[model samples]
Target: MSTSLSSDAAVTGTRVSPPSESRLRSNLVLVTLLTCQLMIVLDITVMNVALPRIQADLHFSATGLSWVMNAYTLVFGGLLLLGGRAGDLFGRRTLFIAGATLFTLASLAGGLAPSAAWLLAARVVQGIGGAMAGPSTLALLTTIFREPKARIRVLALFSGMSSAGFAIGLIVGGLLTEWLSWRSVLFINVPFGLLVVVLALRYLPRAERQSAHLDLPGAITATSGVAALVYGFISAASHGWGNATTDISLAAGAALILAFLAIESRSAQPLLPLHLFRDRNRATAYASMFLAPMAGMSMFFFLTQFLQDVLGLSALATGFAFLPTALLMFTMIRTIPRLLPRFGPKPLTMTGTASMVAGLILLTQLTDRSGYFPLLFIAMILMGFGIGLAVSPLNVIIMSNVEPHEAGAAGGALQTLQQTGASLGLAILVTIFGTTSRGAGGSVQHALVSGMTAAFAAAAGIAALTFVVAFIYRNPRPAN
Candidate 1:
């Protein structure tokens, strides 16, 4: 079956053809996008489970080991706007294939790395590939599912996969690290990436090439700014924030970020269109996306360490412990469409964020004697539900209100914020953990509580802010 494009002045003026074999082809596209999304999300958490092994194998110093995660996240977040623009200018399909290929190759390189430098370089390349591919996934979905109802359903599924993918990654990472080898975690991306590329080539509708110009200044400023900020935070994890170098790095990062905003406001073609945040809902969504992940990512980071370092669980068992959280998150996602119409996103998001806060607060009570059954289980469930509830609605709000022509940019910006949040959150939380851990004289239990309490307190504060933000969202009129 084929689709035909027609010019519509009311929409973007760029003609969009409806898929001829809508149901089958649409589902196929969804699967392909989900696969890509899952791979990217998995990369974030999978390495976490294997950090210890990677460190031991490569003889990496504590500061250097974080490069395994930071390299990927920094590159991915930095180049995202460029990638999104590439999709618009070239074609989403072309970019997706190229990105997938690059990602696959990088994964192969990372798997075989014999030294910390090799692994870190491979991770940077992987991030570049991910930056290219990730935005296209959401862009393709937007172009394919134009209707409100259909788009919401697709977005819900996509959002759920994204939220739950980290947990799934933990499980997969653990299984691979425990049963096969830590290297297998990186190697596993090979088959999945190849599969996504092949399926995308066959199933995705070809998009018209747009002649969009790259926002070079905006891109440079934003990327460098974010990198500096991330570097400063990570540096503070090891060097005290009062250290001259740490202060200099952070001050420089802050200046660059401020300059990035200034450049964006003046540029005709901004990499991150500042106008997207004009809508109160979108702005609030962006803020919530950033803060929500700050605590959320820290939870996974420290918790994984606690499980292995403090509780003495094998990697495999540690991964299994998170299964319940992943399951509950997926379940909550399925209910979003039904619930959105009845209650609207405001109540759901507020409630979910509150639940997450509760979970994080509960987690602060952990000690050497705490077991997985009651304390860990309850915390994981709350975290999952809170994140699940916020993620779906957040995506819907960001994409739902934007014009079709801007979908790619909006999606890219949304993802960029999400990743940046995760990276920043991890850095800050690591600092808190490291500082407290040091002050506690290396007592694992005391350090865990000190870091977790601070992290959870921040999370609760963010959630409370989100509750106020939810008030900005107007309830949609009930269906007659």
Candidate 2:
């Protein structure tokens, strides 16, 4: 749900011998890719638990602390489209390695940062690296596994890593901050990144570059447009929607996006293919992906606050609390490929959506008196498994039947909407919490719970919309 990877068995006209050695080699390659994905996803929130510590050690102003996260989100979301197309044209493997390398070096620089400016600059580099590598991570996975079923299994794992990574990031951040220091959160990525780089060098094949115009105009508009939109959402979350900065950023973002879409419609070599949305199933899948995160991200943000502000849980305990969700989610995701042949994407998506909705409904029952009890634990489990169920099929549907060259762009758009949803969800939910808490006539704890429950209900509504989208899926069998 935190938002959003594949295989290759050769399908000859005649049955070919299954290459055991080839499968093993592909598995090794998958390890490299998943580790890279885990690193990227983990970094997204790995610093979250350590933010207070970061503010203290770095003497960050209360207002400035939010930038630590926003700087990464803005750049990362903005350049995703350009990065996707660049990978498609320039060679996915090349771009992946370059991006991963830059991210690793930036992590090192960030870990050693003596000032807030230095850290923020490093975070920007990390975002750039993430955008360049993120789309290719999925694109390359599909390239390696040509067989449809194998690709689905790999995608399941790739997606499982993403959903799990967000929760895992919280845990890792807490442990690092508690046992070591806030610096450890940034330092941790260096080793992971280096390992991914080394393994990729050993295992990944160099892609043949496509011959095409670089689409500089598309790149410019897509980058600036998405960046502006992300900034707008960030500003909204921080300063409310009425702020001039938020209004300007949001309006500029809308204008730029419209311009970008117009360009894509006419351009022969568009960054995002307009035709991808022609398939009702694929379009619905993308919509579900966008909505899924609106629920999931808000849950994470509000629940974290509830754990701390209401229940008075320590950072370490709060981090560990999410373990049930992550574990259940990972378990369910691994089994999704098996279910796909029986129930298909539509059923799995609907079921997952229902489970998530139920989970959010349970969360709405939280009160100032509530503790980490059966209800909270059950809700976490449901939320985790629901997301695992819903996300993989959507990815399979999007990547399925996609032309090999277009995989990067598809991955980019999928993730771009996803990140956009995450930012916007947080903004909207935070606003809801503020309004409800202010209006509630109760003690501070009651007010906090009131606001949280309101947000939870809204999150449930968003999650239910995912079911509506999933219900639109008419395909009985998987594509490709």
Candidate 2 per-residue lDDT over residues 27-128, each given as its tens digit? 767888898888888888888888989999899999999999989989989988899989999999999999999999999999999999999999999999
TM for candidate 2 is 0.95
The global C-alpha lDDT for each of the candidates, from Candidate 1 onward, is 0.78, 0.86
Query: For candidate 2, which ten residues in a row score worst on lDDT?
Result: 1-10
Candidate 2's C-alpha runs over 4 A off are: 1-21
Q: How do the residues 1-480 of candidate 1 rate in per-residue lDDT, one tens digit apiece?
A: 122122221122354434444445566677888898899989989988888888999999987887888788778887777787677767878998899889999999999999989999999999999989988888777677776676677777888888898899999999999998889999999999888889888777676776677777877877787777766766676676787877887888789889988998998867777898888767877777777777677677778877887788999999998898899889987888677767777788888888887888888778767888788899898989888987777777777667656677788878877887776666667676666666774566767767666666666666667666666776552121
What is the lDDT, from 0 to 100, of the residue 366 in candidate 1?
A: 81
Clash count for each candidate, listed in order shown: 0, 5
Q: Please report how far candidate 1 places residue 422 from its true position, in Å.
A: 1.9
| Candidate closest to the true structure, highest lDDT | 2
Cα RMSD, model 2: 3.7
